[model samples]
Target: MKAKGRVLIIDDDAGIRDAAFQVLSREGYEVEMAGTAEEARRLVEEYEFDVILLDLKLPGVEGLELLQEIREEDPQAQVVVITAYGTVQVAVSAMKLGAADFLQKPFNPQELRLAVSRALEKKRLTLENIYLKRALAEKEGQVEFIGQSPAIRRVLEQAEMAAQTDSTVLLTGESGTGKGLLARLIHRMSPRAEGPFVAVDCGTLVPTLFESELFGHVRGAFTGATQHKIGKFELANGGTIFFDEIGNISLDIQAKLLKAVEEKEISPVGSHRLVRVDVRIIAATNKDLREEVRAGRFREDLYFRLHVISIQLPPLRERREDIPLLAEHFLKRYARKHCKPVEALSPEVLEAFLRYPWPGNVRELENTIERLVVFARKPVIGPEDLYFAGFEDQAPDLTLEEDLPLEEVEKRHVLRVLRACGGNKTLAAQKLGIDRKTLREKLKRWGVTP
Candidate 1:
């Protein structure tokens, strides 16, 4: 069986170490015993432990000093100090030095396990608080949809109704059509609003590390895996896990994912034990999954499983009526973000925006508006400024030349977008509707420093 948690028992007394190891091992924890402070330090450097049992008196190094060192290495480390009888004051000193709790020297198996459990709980809570805080901060201002078009209203209606249920949702739209944003909105409005919203960018995931990235791995599971790590599915337990660009995942992964989606359980990379997860699956894909299934690129079973409820987001061009509102929205946001006095777009600029194909959709429009806001020397953006921003000239031309290799065309287009974004990689990636990592990888492959 997979251990419930990993633990380290450090004590100079072989008898006490053996007793504690037997007790914890029986309780289903992976227990390691260290007879000295040096041995304990070696183990600590090698693997991560959920809890550590440290005897207050050890050879060579003082227990309190070792405890301080351990805490220094990992401030979140949970250490339960063991002290001799009537040494409660010494234990109190250990606590002041970052020890989580204390165990009396004559502690029985029950007392030993209880202390470890409390320490593990404290560690879990501390990590959870940190994760939730970071998640919440990333989610600020991300849930709002900025369009009022009928097409948007329809999508919003479906999303609202879908949020109230636990059913899986498949969001289909062109790239940069706000599928991710809509997914966040659904999560925020759902019953699990308080739970974490974890998003996995399927397109950016390396095929080799995909499984471990999604399902986690145990310590020493594979090369460079030095510690047990939780995956996105587990991290999203009790909440939603959004699989962005889901159609990009390969067939082998699709097979493994199918079982998890069906069973709501995941097997970590090197473990036979299956972990049950309670996560609402919200999968977004720019690809036509139906076509992908027919083409044998996507699994039919997974497709049907993920398609319990479907919401299609209209691309920005299809909802051109909302372009003015969206433009204003992005303008105000970037104006405030860059501390610019730019407030609105000129009539000609808005007309040009309406006429552009916007292959990158809302994201492209947003980046263009932000660039205008940042570079605008006056209160209102005019056509003359659009010339400098290159929106009118560098807008991607979908038309392909017969002799131009697709790769060359792509390189030119990406470079153009990057130039238009003023060499801002983040803005360039957003304008191209790809993650910054993907953009960096592409640039690296193209012999460009990113």
Candidate 2:
């Protein structure tokens, strides 16, 4: 069985150390002991412990000084000081140096056990608080799934079933299809809901720091690594780790990540010891891994490892039945967020939205709604508002006439294509048979802001 927690006992007395070790071991904690300050320093550097028991009167070094050093290295360290009778003053000094708690000398087995348990509880709460803050900061307060369409219901069904097991999940969909939101939902439904849910954007990770970002590194591990850093995997221990845009990662990183996903172990960038992590992997990608593997762009083994259970999120156009619901959802959300009085979309506006092909998926729809809400001039958004928001259904007249300049013809055609694409610059560029950068340059020359 896995130990309840790891504990380190640092004391000079042989009998005291043995007694504490046996007591904690009987309670299912992995225990380690250090007789001297030097040995304790080495043990602390090599392993991560949940709680530490320190003797205030070591031979070579003052116990308070050692406590300070430990706390300096790891601000979250939980150390309980052991003081002889009548040495309460010295124990109080240790507390000022960051000791978590102090145990009186001639402590019984129950006292020792209680001190360790309290220290472990404090550490657990501290870590949860830190991870919770990070999780909230990473999100923009978006709700998960909001529609009752068959396409959406099927996805929710699959997700709910997947959440019951610890299997790896691969979420495949077009950009902005709520893959991240679905991942969060699965995490909340899983048994590890109390644990952290860490999301890593594989597409945005710097190649040079990718390994360190996922597995962490010790101090002095690199030129700028001034202090010990925890990685995403370690932070997500006992929870879920969501890798967004997994297809964008290189083959090299795929290879490095394979071992971690397969064995639940990671070796930090500069450490030789492999740390075990209990994380559920949920990877999202806009690309088909099968095609990537056939083209030799992705590793076959890694793809198989991550494809244990696949869930494909339907695009917005495929679930047109849910458009009204989604539009209203975003409308109310952004309306209240931007303090706009907009309450409804006109009939013509809703018709235009249904007729339009949402190439950018739900994300594009959300951005469009937010823009409209921010610039709304009345309680109900009308068809006229769509024109200003760039979702206008009417196409510009482009009849060729004599004496028209070539630049004028090109500009009108580009603008027409831009409007057809719902102001999605990337999609507009593709439709115009040009790169986004070139398209933007042309728009700038034409006195238009892209």
Candidate 3:
């Protein structure tokens, strides 16, 4: 898949603009150039850019002024200042104005590409981080999720299809498979891109406050209701409300949600008035909603409503071939973040990454890369660094813990290995230094079947 990013190059010099454009375009980036700060400002206003290369000196307005304007336009745009060798001070000043990084005037192709890559990587990570913060709250997030595998591409295709409609969408996947990221992407691609995006974690909401939190409440609605409160649906009016971990909500709340979803209207707690809302609904859950419905925990009506257009994100293990791409993306990100001199992961490190099952998925790998960058001893991270980064498969032996019986410990270790290897018994057995037959017997004793 092509990189989903645009780069803006603002330089008065024709040669510099052409050179930068050529380099970025060749790297699969949509490159736009501006001869002056005015043109650059227009483009910045017209389009969203993942990275902006701003020359320190422009013809009419100073580049620093343009940088400030760009920050004003979109504070999240990654602006990288371009300066002559002796003008390092000016570049430093640009950074204070929200410039992401600085590049020397005579920088080589490698430096230019690396700088742009790092900036774009940062942009991608920011999206995921924002998504996670809204959905999971105070959790680390994944970076660039580019993958050429047919599986991931299919998921993107499904997302694009879902984006074309105002119908309810249900995204199902393993945790860290980036369901929240996909939800935001769908919103951005939809007609409501300019509107607010309200994300609610059903699992995080208190059961007692679920109805009021989702449907708003009037003044004196309850003992604690001192004033009127606007809920998520009202906040997401004219936009989208992402119901993350949707299966965790109570059936009582599900009935209320179903009525509001169907009618596009809600009645506040202790209020007879019906408030209409024009909001798109996108629900996500790691749990199987079908199972929840069958178990009577989730309302079948609500499940049918949300299961309109479903997209299933493939787990990281199913697309191991994409590990290197993801790893390199995160490596550049955290390296630039911690101001580490690290450049890339060594081949051995990539091999180790591919070897690991990544049971915790993309979020696990992203966090590991950040930690590795902080403690990296060299410019290139190898297997030793990967091991130090805790990529090795070493779970605590339950037998060694206090009051743990040998049989219980063995069963727990087997289950742990099975989970780490993504339900592959052969691989789990190999990692445990046991044959498949022995692992099967051990698992059978734990009431697990192949």
Give all TM-scores, in the order shown. Answer: 0.68, 0.83, 0.58
lDDT of 2 by residue, 1-450 (tens): 978888889999999999999999999999999999999988776666779898888898987889987775555559998868537678678878888998988989999889999999998788777778787788657446888999999999999999999999999987678898999999989998878889998866798899999988877789999887778898898789999988878888888899899888887777664566789999998888999999998999999999999999998878988999999999999998888888999887788778655655687778778877877899999978877865563333323565866566567767777978889998886654344655675788789984
Number of the predicted model whose TM-score against the real structure is largest = 2
In order of TM-score, best first, we have 2, 1, 3
Q: Which structure among the candidates has the greatest lDDT?
A: 1
> In candidate 3, what are the lDDT values of residues 1-450, reduced to their tens digit?
544467889888899899888888888888889987778877876665678998877876877787887876555579998877436578668878888888987989899999998998786566545444555653335423478888999998988888989989999986678888888889988998876688887866889998998877767779988766667786676689999888878878888999999988787786664555778999998778888888889998889989899889988878998888888888898888899999998887777667555545777677778878988999998767755754454433411556756456556656776888899987765555443554665677678975
Residues 298-404 of candidate 1: C-alpha lDDT, one tens digit per residue:
99999999999999999886899999999999998999999998878999888878866565789878878887887899998998898777665664454456687
State residue 108's C-alpha deviation in candidate 1, in Å.
Answer: 15
When sorted by lDDT, best at the front, the candidate numbers are 1, 2, 3
Clashing residue pairs, backbone N/CA/C < 3 A, model 3: none
Q: Each candidate: how many clashes? A: 0, 0, 0
The lDDT for every candidate, in the order shown, is 0.83, 0.83, 0.77
* Ten-residue region with minimum lDDT total, candidate 3: 390-399
Model 1 / residue 268 / CA error / Å: 2.2
The clash number for model 1 is 0
